[model samples]
Structure formats: C-alpha cells, structure tokens
Target: MAAIERYEQWMARLLLFNKPYGVLSQFTDRGSPTARPTLSDFVPVKGVYPAGRLDRDSEGLLLLCDDGRLQARISDPRFKMPKTYLVQVEGDPGEENLEPLRKGVRLKDGMTLPAEATRIEDPGLWLRDPPIRERKSIPDNWLKITIREGRNRQVRRMTAAIGFPTLRLVRWSIGDWTVAGIAPGEFKEISV
Candidate 1:
C-alpha cells in the first residue's frame, strides 16, 4: 500500500485488542522499575491510542481509536455505553448475593450506577498465561456483569463488598464490540 493509503487506513478505524493479563493499557511505559509490557508492545500501529483503560491485572477487550470524538463516546459514562465482564468470584454467590450490585453497591468513592448482574456458566474464554490459583476447598462462581461506569478496581471492589471477592476479571464486551474472535496479544482494526 502507498504511504498516504496506509496513513488514511490507520487513521480511520477501530482497533480491538484482547489485552492479556499484566499488560498496561497505555502506549507509553511510565514508572515501573522493571519494564512492563504495554499496548505499544503489541499494537505498533501509529496515531491510535487506547480509548479506555484495563488495569495491568485485568484482561480482555480494549478499544483504540485515532478519532477523539469516538474515544469520548466509548469512554464517557454520560454516554451510558455498556461494558460487560465475565468475573470469577471467590465463592458461590447465589443470585440473591448480587442484588446489591444490580441495585448500585456503595463504595468508598460512592454508590455505583445500577448495573446488570447474572450468575452464568463459564464463558470458556482464553486461559491466562498464569492462571488464577485454585483453592480446592473454596468454591468459585462466574458472573456475566455489565456496568456503565468505569471506576478503579470497581468490579473487584463490588464483589468484595458483597462478600465474594473477585478471582479473575475479563471484560467481554464494550457497546457492541467484543473479544469474541480476538486472541491474547493480538489485535484487529475494523471500520466504524
């Protein structure tokens, strides 16, 4: 492809990343004594940046865009775009235990917006390189959760507050986009 062709192509699309565990969502490395892997490591595409963040510990679908307006639309809570997650909790939290989360669980920061919570079967998503530890005696359960707001460690805090600590958290979808076809450390750009 021509240089201008490639530039235009790179500038006008959405890049979906299935961010692996331990990778920073940003393009630049900030302040770790050891060099942590970043989105830049996998996505060499220029101009586009992550629209939202997925903590270094969390994994799954992360969106990137060169268009600032589209980035705002995806990341702003006021837009009420849905972000869904498949969360594994430390214990078997019955449906009733999740009622508080659905009703907006209060946290140190404040009450979260009411969200969608449902006990679900294992999503059969990709395995983490370093898997979550298993305690044979303690049971674990999965949940399909969708929240509109993005807070720091929000999913983990919500589950912990309700007495079921989070084990593994994977963002399954954002708005209509999903990590359904992407694999860890890989990414693809799609037309808006």
Candidate 2:
C-alpha cells in the first residue's frame, strides 16, 4: 500500500455495533423528560461518531467511524450503498403487496428510489425488552428489504404506504457488512 494510504488505514477505525431498541443513535441527549439510553452508554470508543443513524425504535447494524472519508462513503446516498433490512410487518404481505416498494413510493419528502424487496422466513431474533404490542386479529409477515437511500424513517414509511405497517424492523446488513455475530448493545472494531 502507498504511504498515504497506509497512514489513512492506520488511522481509520470502523466499528459495527448492534444497536438495541430504546437507545438513541446519538452519544448525548440534548433534552428529554425521560432519561433515554444513548450510544455512549454502550460504546467505550472515543472520537468516533455514527456514520449514519438507526432510529431509537429500530435495531441492528450501526456503523461508526472517526475517518471522514470512510464515514461519508457509507452515509452518503449518492454512493448507492445498499442497506438490507429484515422487516416484520403487521399483516401478511405477499409478493403483490411488496411490488410498490420495489417500484418506489411517493412520500411527502418526494419519490423514493426503487428497492429490492422479498419475502423472508421468520427471523429468530432476540426479544426486545418491552416488546411490541400484540393485537390478536392482526397477522404478521416478514420481508427482506434492500434500499440504497437512507432517509429518515424511510423503511417504515415505505411499508406503510404499501398498506402493511412495519411492526418490527431489524437492519441485517449495510453494503458488504453484516450484524451476524454482534448482539444488542455489543460492538466489534475493524481497521481497514
């Protein structure tokens, strides 16, 4: 490797954290009546910030970095890095129900780019502490969704637009990275 490249790699730190539900994506809380948990509570590493955000209600792969270029490459939508999600919607969503998401949906923010979506088997995941509400009449379905754009609450909105509200959402992968081995509130560091 070139000297500059070597130096950059030596300085770059990438951390893949499996963010738990109810934990804020940020390190600090500006203001809130309740004392919600934040990333700082779990991540001991200093000088690193989340490359992108996973809403407090969502769970799974969250990437953090101290390197500016690496952060931008992963967070910027222009890069078209795919983010895969394992979504559990409120009702059974067959292939026909997911077509609009694949074609793209129009939101108040504007039209979203097309997504790669498919039905998936039930993911035997760790239970959330409080747990999602159980409505006896409403059935649930699982879908694996891949979208390149990272918009605020995009996945939830997309599923809602298709008439299948997301009950539980888990981000399984981002680009070439996956949250396979990490458990909630735990992280693994990698140097690249």
Candidate 3:
C-alpha cells in the first residue's frame, strides 16, 4: 500500500497533475457514447477530487486535493489564485494587441480583469498534436498571458476579439505549481 493510504481517513494532501487534452475532469461520463478515462485513470485516490477544472479541449496543470476544505480553498474564486497560460494565436500580436489585455478587455459577459503580465514570447515550448492550421499569408506568434480569473474559454475569446484568433491554448502554471518536466498524459505528486 502507498504511504498516502494510511492518511486517507485523516489529513488532506495536495497533488499536481498534468492534464492532457481530450480528458474529462469528472470520474465518469455516462453521456458520452465512447469511453474515455477521467482523473481516476491517473490518480488512484478514493476521496480526492480536482480543485479546479480544465476544459476537455484545454490542457495543462491541474490541482487535486484529498480534503474537501483544501479543495474549496483552491477552487474558490474568492482566493483569487493566478493562472498563467501560453497561448499560440493565429496572427502576430503587436504592442497594440496587448494593451487591451493588460488594461482589461470587455467581454460580452463582462469586463475581464487585467492580466498580471503579458509577454510576446516564450522560447521554451513544444508543438501541439494536429498542429494549428497555418495561413501561408498570415503569420502567428506566441503570447504568455497570466490572469486571475478562469472564465470559460476566456483566453480564446479575448485573443479573437483583439484580431488574433487563438490557434491553441495551454495552461502552463497555476498558483505556485507548474507543468514543467511532465510530459503529456503524465502526472507527478507535488509537495504543497
């Protein structure tokens, strides 16, 4: 048995997982016609659950907690934890393209909170499977954007509004945790 087995009934522990694309956040999905494994396929804890959810279409760092209290603390927007994303947009994002993001873009739902930081590039990156389509005439660029809120498809929408559609989106980090060193569909326990 694992060391964590002994503490199952008592203390709660935090774990970091690298959630790969196309995996659902829930343990079971009766609605789907086909079978696809959930976090259970990667994590074998009984009481543990994801703190926050990454969409089935999105991929990146995910936090799970064995304790309900700790789960609430991390998932709650009240905590205001920052999430950083490395986005590949459909076109070159110039200085002008970043201003609205830094200042805060007004989405149809509401005004998005300003990003903590926005940079033009991140040299350390990898190509995506089923690579984003290329428009021979139009070039694309990468942007590392960090924001506190996790609105549904917010990054994709924001970039599209700024005249640069999002070709791909990946959450690189959340709070103090990151997806570094872990490959796709792989996960490792992180000390909180």
lDDT of 2 by residue, 1-192 (tens): 599887876788999999999899999988898888999999999999999999989999999999899999999999999999999899888889889998999988999999999998888898887798878998888899999999999999999999999889999999999999898989999987
Instruction: List per-prediction Cα lDDT, in the order shown.
Output: 0.92, 0.93, 0.79
Which lDDT tens digits does candidate 1 get at residues 1-192?
A: 699887776555789999999999998887878898998899989988889899989999999988888999999888989999999999999879999999999999999999899999988888897999999999998998999999999999999999999999999999999999899999988977
Alpha-carbon RMSD of each model? 2.9, 2.2, 3.2
Tens-place lDDT digits, model 3, residues 1-192? 677776664666777777777788877878879888688777776766889888887778888877777787777877878888888788677788799999989999899999854656654665556566888999888888888887888888888878888877788888888889877767777444
Task: Quote the lDDT for 143 in model 1.
Answer: 93
In model 1, the clashing pairs are: none
Query: Sorted by lDDT, highest first, which candidate order results?
Result: 2, 1, 3
The CA lDDT at 2 in model 3 is 75
Clashing pairs in 3: none
- What 10-residue stretch in candidate 1 is worst by lDDT? 4-13
Q: Order the candidate numbers by TM-score, best to worst.
A: 2, 1, 3
Please report how far candidate 3 places residue 31 from its true position, in Å.
0.7
